[model samples]
Target: MSNEAMQVRALRGRVVTPDHIIDDGAVVLSGSHIAWVGTADQAARAGFGDAVEQAQTAPEGGYLLPGLVDVHCHGGGGESFPNAETAEQAMVSVLEHRRFGTTSLVASCVTAAPDVLRARTRVLAGLCEDGELAGIHFEGPFVSVERCGAQDPTYIIDPDAALTRELIELGGGHVVTMTIAPEKPGITGDDGVNAALIEGGALPSFGHT
Candidate 1:
């Protein structure tokens, strides 16, 4: 079948596939679903496990699952979203984690105005579509100033569904996750704005107020 239909197998070193360890585990992948998993002997009977026993030159080590998926990381390497500012410059931050095994990455942005956010999303969305990026995450611009972490308080605003929808659309499908403080004390003008954003294809995650 298609590679996408194939399973995830990490026989030798480290593989942390989506979850815990496999140890000397044998992983059977079918499509995106794990068809089977057990010991080396069990996998040998069914076919597929650590080849350590079958090898003499390979590293004498335990079997690692698959790599990890960092859903909340900012930029890559020493580059950060706020520091990088622009999406183009932001890529350096993205590639930093790919080496160790970050298959997917979300380009997070600071609290900026609608136009700036749109511009950043436009670039990040393109990167994601081109396979260089995975998704875009907006952490602020809708957070509570009272509880703002390291983010700039000047960019904080009450959650607005209209802007949120626009931002997502601008990012294309590259925009998937959003960290919003739903309890923020704004959003007074529009009707059903919250529902529109929460339901309009964006995964809204509650953040600190």
Candidate 2:
């Protein structure tokens, strides 16, 4: 038999499924999909044509929550997302977050030399071809220096179309959300640039506050 079918996982305690939760719920997986879920006491009684006996003996567990998705996390486990100097470094941070139940995430750049940002983010975007890196969060280069927090002031600048496009390409064309300061005026907060980013498939999130 295939390894997936041979293995069995029974998480019995507080089971939280996408729809609902069962107090003493249990989920039995015959493979990747959940084969069964119900109260532990009713597991064997409900009847499994061939696996009744085995299901009855599956161990009881603690809280079971399917992996998590953190859309706005800056970093975790001592790793800083904005500090990733290379694609590998960014991946390291991603893996760290995954190990701790963050099934999904976005990289938040803390501001740096445009060239460096492009180089690093492009690699990250390319890596996302494998579905690891979700997207890039540009939190600088267009942010108000007056509100700079954990970002390099030297790299801050007004947001523009050319630079924005360049960064998107650098990120392998995978810009998801960017934190921009729309109140900064001029090209720093141009609507055209925002529209281009949106059309490019990258979501824009305004944040000066």
Candidate 3:
């Protein structure tokens, strides 16, 4: 192995996985990727004995897990994605979440006028392009008023496939999902909002139900 690849590191802790948790586990990391994950003993058997020997032990009873993915976050650190007019402003929320282990986050926009939505999309899309944001999520503008909850009712409108397409284009392919009411018109069929989203490489998130 190259000297760089041989420079492996390990972390010993209660490793949490999808199926179960290992109380005495070790995670071997080679550079930026995880090289191995198993019980401490298994790590040694897997030829990671040196890594395990030099592993940094976690806090007593502490758990080690993967970074979180937050798909519906509006803002943090006193910054709201929906109101951010500049990329710097939106980055505040992104960095705040990243500081807490949320490595991937989707910036969500609330119900707003078409112009406002477009502006926010431009700002957020830039961050996505720069690898700061996972994607963009529009929370409203095509949802039911009765269940709008935090969405602004005044800007709510009937589902418009054309508008959806326009927003997706403005997102520069970084649009991940848009929250839409399933009961709304123009939400299904071939030329509907759902179809537009899917065609444009995005998804419809049923919300404000």
Name the best candidate (by lDDT): 3
- Candidate 3 lDDT by residue in tens digits, 155-187: 999999999999999999999999999888789
TM-score leader: 3
TM-score of predicted structure 2? 0.76
Angstrom error of the Cα, residue 58, model 1: value is 6.9
Instruction: Give one digit per residue, the lDDT tens place, for model 2 in 28-53.
Output: 77777777877777877755434533
Write down the lDDT of every candidate, Cα atoms only.
0.66, 0.70, 0.93
Instruction: Please list the residue runs of candidate 1 whose C-alpha ends up more than 4 Å from where it truly belongs after superposition.
Output: 1-44, 47-63, 83-88, 185-193
Instruction: Write down the RMSD of all candidates, one decimal each.
Output: 4.5, 4.0, 2.5
Q: For each predicted model, how many residue pairs clash, with residues at least 3 apart or on different chains? A: 9, 2, 0
Native-vs-model 1 lDDT? 0.66
List, residue by residue over 85-171, the lDDT tens digit for candidate 1: 565677787777876667777667778777778777777777878887777788878777888887788777767777877887787
Cα-based lDDT at residue 135, candidate 1: 75
TM per candidate comes to: 0.69, 0.76, 0.86
Candidate ranking under lDDT, highest first, comes to 3, 2, 1
